[model samples]
Target: MSRPAQYHLLSLPDGSWETVSCLASVIRCRATTPTVIVDVSAVERLTIDALAVLVRKAMRLRSAGGELLLAGPGPAIRKVIERTGTGPLLPDFYDSAAALRALGDDGRAWQRVELSEGESALFCEPAQSPYCRHRP
Candidate 1:
């Protein structure tokens, strides 16, 4: 029988910069697991620096044969990922159930196209639209 995958959920506050770093370190150190899920649903205000940290950490996890999934991120945090080109770096970005589905079922790689020079950050109005307002 196959063993169950290990998963970790990290919930960050609005301005908890250290938590992001700490979680990254944990993921780096805990390399035995095949899956790690970070739930940033409570993150209301995330800066570019924080996103960079997350991307780098996720990359490290991926390099070690582990996948980092982001689940139920708030609008602000999601916008940061969309704006800073970090979403593509992640294995999967989705709601709770969708994230679970993507845990280890490697059917296809999610669409992770790189953004153009003039098509980076995207700003969504009212925070309800599925699409982002692309900005140069």
Candidate 2:
């Protein structure tokens, strides 16, 4: 029998390299999964560094036969994704459920993950580098 497509709901923090790095780590952990829907509803601002991570990761995931999706980005953030040339790589959805539905899933059997700012610090390099030290 064919395996069911797996989905992860990753709720991101404010658009900072530190916090976004933690979110990136989580996505790395689930690299083999079929889909990851990032919840950006709470993020009022999105940094280019954070957007770069999403674009890079999304490209890698697509190459590996998986996909990374974004959900609930506000008008400003949405415009950024598009103008930055990442809109093609990272498809934006109205919400997590909408992303799931687009993938032909019921969108009910997904796992949700979130990381706080304190937890994100653990994923950053010492001295508060401009970027997370995660390679690949």
Candidate 3:
């Protein structure tokens, strides 16, 4: 995918079970960018359970011939990600702009994408979503 798409995830402030729960449908929507970026700037900390959600989403995107990268982890959250030993798997950036550039998105601010709506982040899905777990 040339000029891979970029999608942003709302920062999780509390990292609590409730915050995680509320993100369920958004993460499982099966419609995201070829390069989904989970922005963690506003997030202060991340739990193992919370990281699991990210990994699952990344895996789902990967299965569809795409990839996922974490963006902007603060000092505390950076410690959590490193201590968890999932750095190689999750691959984070210092900030979202660098992440977007890494994904080949250049200065295309018009292509900004979001995941909370439960619809395609950049465009609508086809009749059968290639990333849908239900697909056989």
Candidate 4:
């Protein structure tokens, strides 16, 4: 089957410990596409625990033959990633467009699925798990 021509976006709330914990739980239960992008543009501050969540997500993706790219992290966030020595493990981009190109996206407007609390999951599976709506 052909890969989905889009990137799934998991938008962070505030990069707080509580929010990151919630995100980690949701991700474990939900299956995402091979190319998932975690957008941190809205994150005003950066925390070590929060950055750990991103690294953990990336490791999971790699095991499943996928990749996780961070998008729109400011200098503060970048410093944490570097300080934590996860820069080599986690590749990031200044924006989604740059990330798309790096992933070989044809510069077309691909679809997106933004994950957040309160809202329905962009990709969710039942226990038996026949399908997920956010494939690609």
The candidate that achieves the highest TM-score relative to the unseen native structure: 2
Clashing pairs in 4: none
Cα lDDT tens digits for candidate 1, 44-110: 7776767777887677666556667877777777677777777777644557567877754755433
lDDT of 4 by residue, 1-136 (tens): 5556556667776889778766655665554455687778888787788778778878866765667888898888888888889987678898877777777755556666544433224334342322223435
Q: How close is candidate 2 to the true structure, as a TM-score?
A: 0.72
* TM-scores for all predictions: 0.64, 0.72, 0.67, 0.71
Off by over 4 Å in 3: 1-9, 30-34, 105-110, 114-136
Error of 3 at 108 (Å): 10
What TM-score, to 2 decimals, does candidate 4 have?
0.71
- For model 1, which pairs clash? none
Best by lDDT: 2
Q: Superposing all C-alpha atoms, what RMSD in Å does each candidate have to the true structure? A: 15.2, 6.4, 5.8, 6.1
Cα lDDT for residue 127, model 3?
35
Q: Residue by residue across 40-91, what tens digits does model 2's lDDT show?
A: 9889888899888888778766765667888898998998987888888889
Model 2 residue 78 CA deviation (Å) reads: 0.6
| Global lDDT scores for all candidate models | 0.58, 0.70, 0.62, 0.68
lDDT of 3 by residue, 1-136 (tens): 5444445545555665556544534455534665566677787777778877777666666766666677787888678778887776677898877776776645555256655344554333343433332323
